[model samples]
Target: MPHPILTDLETIASSTAAENGFDLCGVKVFTHLKPMTMQVQIRHIGGGDVSLEECASFSAPMGEAIETSQLLNEAYVLEISSPGIDDQLVNDRDFQTFRGFPIEVAYRNDQGSELRQAGLLHKRSTDHVHLNIKGKINRILRKDVIAVHLTRLKG
Candidate 1:
């Protein structure tokens, strides 16, 4: 289990991100760094790429909140950014929001080699996803998809 402090930090970060017109994607603490660092990833609530200016704006208040709450005993580096176009489709909200978009799912083949399946995400359910690939509807379990990423189209 993650430390309670981490969860508290995530809450504060989430509130700050929401105020900044973003959804809190995730919060991570990297203890391997020299002074330790906290990374807070955010995504635009309405859907779009988050710019560096937005990250800066979001970081300032989040840092202040962490400092005010004394969430960390010592100074910790804080980083903020969008989850990026290729971030994994982990949660149901992600699957719903990205429906109808082209995505690439990496799965293990019979030989255990990594195989990729490209398709348009038609829909999703609690346990599986419906994909339109090669003019056929392929129903795949969420677990079968090792990684699901948005496929950036050339045109």
Candidate 2:
């Protein structure tokens, strides 16, 4: 059988994302924007966080990449920007990068309820992240993490 031509929307969207300088592009599941819009977070090695200015800056080129791809020609909303404050923390690397900052993490606890904990990001190993909760610390395995993020603590 002839190899099937790759026509999955995700594959095309990912390609467009890379061409537009996005380190990662994933299918955002929730659509209601009930809390916030799921986003495409871009991480540039050695580059600083994607600022609002940068997002606006890349708008034209990013749109061009998506438009030229010929993948989705309809009026599908193309959001070109940085990962916002409400975005989820994905892994140990994310913890490592945001170390020393306050973070909110969602993970399954011993009881299996989705638990949300906030603390200072302490350390990251290959498989776990160390969080300093108040003065005490706890190491959480990566697999248990449903989400994590740097949170600003207002005094």
Candidate 3:
């Protein structure tokens, strides 16, 4: 379960992110640190890439909103960032969003040997992941998959 404060902060962050043309993807509040810490992850609307300048541009308004809310009693650190280009595909949304994009799948074969395959993401079923390599479709069992990651190809 998340702390109540985190929930409230997420609401505020989400609102702020929307005002700045971003979608709030994640939020974390750490109270264990000396002065506390808040980390926010955001992505541009319409699945566009997020730039560092955009993150910096958003920080000011977001910080102002947090300050105006008076949600924190003490000093805290606020870090804003994007989900990143090379982030692993971890959920159904990720699979859907990156459909038809290049990806690398790492999995274990029947002999327990680790293998890797790269291709255009086709789709993910309940029990398998399908990839289009060249003109052929390859399907790997979900249970045997280790990780699926977005890959970049040099032009």
Q: What is the lDDT of candidate 3?
A: 0.90
For candidate 1, write residues 38-116 as lDDT tens digits.
9999989886778999898888888888888887997689999887677778777788888888888887765678878
Give the per-residue lDDT of model 3 (tens digit) for 55-126. Answer: 988989989999999988899998999886677888787899999989999999999999999999999999
Query: Which portions of model 3 miss their true places by more than 4 Å?
Result: 85-93, 100-122, 125-155
- The better-scoring model by lDDT among 2 and 3 is 3
* Tens-digit lDDT track of model 2 for 8-45: 53455466556756665244423444442323445543
Best by TM-score: 1
TM-score of 1: 0.73
lDDT of 1: 0.83
What does the lDDT read for residue 23 in candidate 3?
Answer: 87
What are the per-model numbers of colliding residue pairs? 0, 0, 0
Taking all chains together, each candidate's TM-score versus the true structure is 0.73, 0.70, 0.64
Clashing residue pairs in candidate 2 (N, C-alpha, C atoms within 3 angstroms): none
Error of 3 at 68 (Å): 1.5
lDDT of each: 0.83, 0.63, 0.90
* Number of the top-ranking candidate, with lDDT as the measure: 3
